[model samples]
Target: MKFAQPLWNDLKCQLQDGFILDTSWTNIYLPNAQILGIGKDITAHKQSKQVLNTQIEQEKLMRNIA
Candidate 1:
């Protein structure tokens, strides 16, 4: 099955945040006909990390207040 544009866009965003994107393909007719690909987007990964860190800090603050 082919991936949708929205899904692809999301994947790209994640990649930009420094997350890694991996894909694999295999042929049914040939067991040995397999392919794999992997990539990383440093900018996205960094952004994602920052967002996660901010969320964690917020949660910690809330817990301390409670």
Candidate 2:
């Protein structure tokens, strides 16, 4: 059996903050089956770090002047 393509894509990228995942499989004499998973890209973390660094630098400059 084949599943929908968009549904599969969505499943692969559905990671959210503080969400836990559990996996299970059943064997019922089926021919074949597949499970899909998704996760966030590392770029998201990098971008967040850049924003935080900018905020910290701004705070530091403000303190030095005052």
* lDDT for each candidate structure: 0.53, 0.51
**lDDT tens digits by residue: candidate 2, 1-66:** 773433211122224785443322222333356543444345455558889999999999999999
Estimate TM-scores for all models.
0.39, 0.39
lDDT of 1 by residue, 1-66 (tens): 553322222233334678555433232332356533333445556578889999999999999999
The weakest ten consecutive residues by lDDT in model 2 span 5-14
In model 1, which range of ten residues has the least summed lDDT?
Answer: 4-13
Give the residue spans of candidate 2 off by over 4 A: 1-40
Q: Backbone collision count in every prediction? A: 7, 1
Q: Could you list the CA RMSD of all candidates, in the order they appear?
A: 9.3, 10.5
Q: Give the number of the best model, judged by lDDT.
A: 1
